[model samples]
Target: MLLVPAAHAQGPAPALPTAKPRPPAPAQPAADPAYEAARAAFEALPEAQRRAIQDSLVWTGDYNAVTAGTFGRRTYEGIVGWQRRQGVEPTGILTVRDRPALDAAGEAVRKSLRFTVQADPASGAVIGVPEKLLARKSPLPRGTRWQSTDGRVTLDTTSSPPGGTDLDALFERATAVTPERKVTYKVRKPDFLVVTGETPTGRFYIRHAAGADGIRGFTMSYDKTLTAEVDRLVIAVANSFSPFPNAAPAPEATPSATLSPGGARPGAGAPAPFAPPPLPGSVARPVATGLALGNGRVLTAAAALETCPSPLIGGAPARLTLRDPTGALALLEGGQHAQGAQPPAIRVEAPASGEALVVLGAEAKGAAVAPGTAGAGSVFAPLQPGAGGAPVLDRSGRLVGLVARFPATPRLIAGVMPPTSHALVPAGTIAAFLAQAGVAPGELAPAHPQGASLGAAAAPVLGSVVAISCGR
Candidate 1:
């Protein structure tokens, strides 16, 4: 105790050790105005065009994220990466000059792969496949499957009804650490799940979505040796996947053959009965018109068949045989037709501008006709949604062209946008397409007497036009 008294005096001056202060966080880099401007320019493009650019980047091995067609940090980084590879300043902007080269490069790869977008007939899900790569296609019990020639790359699409396994179970099974699989990443959401991992000899990507129609998803696996070529493709395929295409119509709203005045053959009996209304979140069926090309062939707009897994022509199943490279027309084979129906004659010479024309179509209500005028290369008419592929006839009842469904391009008038108009595929183009398909169109006969009314001119071809309905 006495010794502690002397130490207490010295101990009072002693202070506890002090903790070191933390260093300040690193500063963020300043925003680049040029890069922002570049992004703005890219964002201004249409969604389809944006996705195309991203696809080009992926093909060039500069992008590895989803091709969502939306602007974000990942997209920006991809653009910058592409710019750097071109040996130019990395402004992250694609100039008009730069785009052509990039698109050409991408197109080459697509051509080699025979890339195409298709919907699974079983699940009604849309996805992109490299047709040349996956030369073999087979049916699954509840889905569809595709594989490469050597079976190194495989794709499988599957679905389950409402009372089937839940998402939790699926997630657990997909991510399970089996001896043959090693999951590297996984994500789960209320209505979807995505898992990526490596197999014993390859890599795999799985995606699934839940909805009123139940669960729908796909799995893609590719050999490890081809990772350089397939890694980016996985992102593209995923982006294009649509578990439930929004364009699909409700069962009840599907247009029946009877809806078209000309759809019923001479004696096809009563129209098919309609189903109950579709469940919540269903859309109207996409409808279009088609022209009867004799011998079980039909011609229609290709756009209407974009997401259709099973296309119906006048309530009969049909197969698409050929498509116009210009994306304006498609030829369907094996469609049913009335007996002794004569296809309309085709006029090779285009109509002069301002010439009166008649547009014939099988509309929702019935067979209908509208007056039009020939422009430089298109027929100008007040066309409706299902008017595509309607026959455009001359005063002599000769086929001049077919209505084409083009996206409504907005135009500025006095700083205001107005409704857009529709155009048609000219006779010359249609003739060339027919020739390529080895179908000789009927030659035009002697001209009819002058001054024939539009209604009278269209009468001969009314029954030849039929409505086209597609189911997803």
Candidate 2:
């Protein structure tokens, strides 16, 4: 009664007392000029080189973001952190002197981990794995499983068909608390789910995403003691995950010499060729196309050979016989084919700008073709990743050039998109290279009409193309 009387006397207590005003946040320190200069320098580097640097940072555990080549606040902070750890001024930039040491440190860790990207045939999923850490691999009911040597870490990849357990149901099961499992963090979205918590053995993390192919996901568990190491690895694995990569072609039976029309069969004394074993566990092997030069010889891009000194040509091991000084061409002396398979006619004349052309390559569906137009020294065409070393033929099927490089991945240039084009090695250069290697340039075929179908003109040469794969 006394309190009510006091409030009434004060006319509603002068309204509720207002909250005190918060002090203005301290002015943010100005950005360091050195940091700005370093960022500018990094951004000026080639995209591929920039990505390599980011990859190094990831291995060193200073970065947890995707190796996208694009720099951002996270990348700057990571650089600064690494600098501090190296007992250098925190410049937030990698100088020429700093790069060597950084690379060495990162390389050591990478070697120890033996990280590799693997394509899982069972679940049709591609992911990166620390092969050295997870040496034990086993088949699961729905997919594949990998475990560490001491059984302290484990990874499982699973897939479900459409109309199977929906995302909601899976999330429920993943997050449900059991007597031995404690749920800590959970998130559910329209097309994905994530659950993390503790288990009797250690901690666990699960991620699943819905796609047209249904659901694909992975679960990882490791001992608490490995949190620091495992956490960085988790970021890399997640960034490298591809639920559905391009479908690889099924293994095919070796073609007989008769398949090459107008080609001479090998002599009876010729050694029998054999296909290399399927890449260990279907790893993400580097692949390219090669042109057969008859007499057990082949020509392909030198870059592909750099990764795998002994590459497989048409699934058989090949020996490098010669490499062009420019590093754009390579010759292999093994992987025996039909003795006198007619090599595609090499036209010394380069294709004129805007000339219509056809590109031929060895693909999942045997020989594939794509229409293209010749530029000043390149070709504009929609090409796939392994298209390098493919043959570019004129409208009349005459060899015009070879695809030296694929189009670079798209990048923004001052907020503008750059033109997409692939590099082409002219037929003149190829002919000279062939002469230097002592290989005969085959005779030209009768020219087809300009209006003739490019695909028809390329038919004869398709048989000469072979798929080249290199493995770690």
Candidate 3:
């Protein structure tokens, strides 16, 4: 039986009743020439300069960097911008500070471009492609059982290894340093899709190293075999590991930064959908309910808005704006903080970044906003729009640490996808599944089987699954 996701079960919804969904938009027909050109330059560049060059690429997929960027896979503009920030003239472009100290630091980042998968950097583990898993040509049959050594395959590592890479080496390396994490198989194009109120969580990934633009719009459907293959992986992995307990946060679904008031003009090739971040010690006037920030903006907790005890809703309608001390609104967007509340958020980054800022929770409106807030030592109030959470801002007016992780309440049960005895999905695992499914991994929406008892805490066994490994 197919499981359909209720709008709420998928994610936080907007305030407007007829708000449209935000995924499966049509992708630009042509966006691949970048790779070929970059590849040539990469092969010609010295090893020292190569990593810097690869890092400069603005491709959409992660694994694509592992593949295409190895040869060439970044946009010239994005690379130039990254290099300029790195303090290298490459071709003698822009420079921030001529101080030797800053120059040396920028050079170090350029030099440290390993472009390789980090092996649980703390644990000394290496993540890489599973040769055997990639060698398979045909799809596995439905109901095919795979043995798992890890009993917690559904939620954590409750499931054992399937025909993918054994993460022992990666795990051991990162064992003491970072939390244990392993990269596994993914569907190049996934069949199963998890549609939420705003975005669709598709369970697969397709690598694209050199991309000049963001994945604004795209769509796909899976064949039966591919669909089943992708399903098997999701059942076994995806959101499996709770690195920070309840840390399966997705990117915010909104638009951000474009024009600023008072003549602070946008840079060349300004991105569509923009929202600058708040300057230090300043706040944005919450307009039209919410705001966005960051080049690739961040979003605050909207679903948590309703928690505000005395939410004030009566006001003349206005263009929603995300602000900082400097005060620059990116775009006019719609957001729903809660039924009766409002959580103001905005993006400051460029649309070209192909990044999203979705926060799980924040400091209460009464507290102070910080540079970032994802770990311990932070007090987050229940995210009720306008009630409060930590403040997030990018250098230019970007809000990075956004999103509200409201406590598990009757209305927010779907917002929390606990690892079950049957399924566990992680970010990296989802990437692999997307690769296998033959679709862009992050492009797909969240997927869950219909009638599946999500209430079960632990994950299941003997089925493929995705698992996230967090630092214990």
Using Cα atoms with residue i matched to residue i, what is each candidate's TM-score against the true structure? 0.46, 0.44, 0.18
Top candidate on lDDT is: 2
| Pairs in clash, predicted candidate 2 | none
- Enumerate clash totals for all models, in the order shown: 0, 0, 141
Candidate 1 off by > 4 Å:
1-27, 246-472
Residue 189 local lDDT, model 3: 7
Please provide, for model 3 over 1-472, each residue's C-alpha lDDT reduced to its tens digit, 9 standing for 90 to 100.
Answer: 0100001122332332222232242332564554555546545655544434332231211111211223312234444445565667643222334233333543353334222222222211122211222222221221111222321111111111222212222222222221222212111001011221101222222111001111111111222333433332321122111111212323321111111111111221121101011122223223112322211122223332322222221121212222222111112222122122222222322222312111221111112111121222122221222312223222222223323222322221111121111111122332332233232311111232221211110011001010100111
lDDT of each: 0.63, 0.64, 0.23
lDDT of 3 at 389: 26
Query: Model 3 has how many clashing residue pairs?
Result: 141
lDDT of 2 by residue, 1-472 (tens): 0000010111221222232332343454687787788789888888787767877887888876556676656578778889999999888878888889888987888778898889887776787889999999999977899999999989899988665756556755886778999965443333454566787768887877655466777888889888778877776676567665653322342332111221111121111101011122232333677788876667876654544555775455665666676768877655555234567778787788988777775543244455577898887764444667888888777888888855333332211112246788888888878877667877656656554454356657767777676633
**If both were scored by lDDT, which would come out higher, candidate 2 or candidate 3?**
2
Question: Best to worst by TM-score, what's the order?
Answer: 1, 2, 3
Worst 10 residues of 2 by lDDT: 1-10
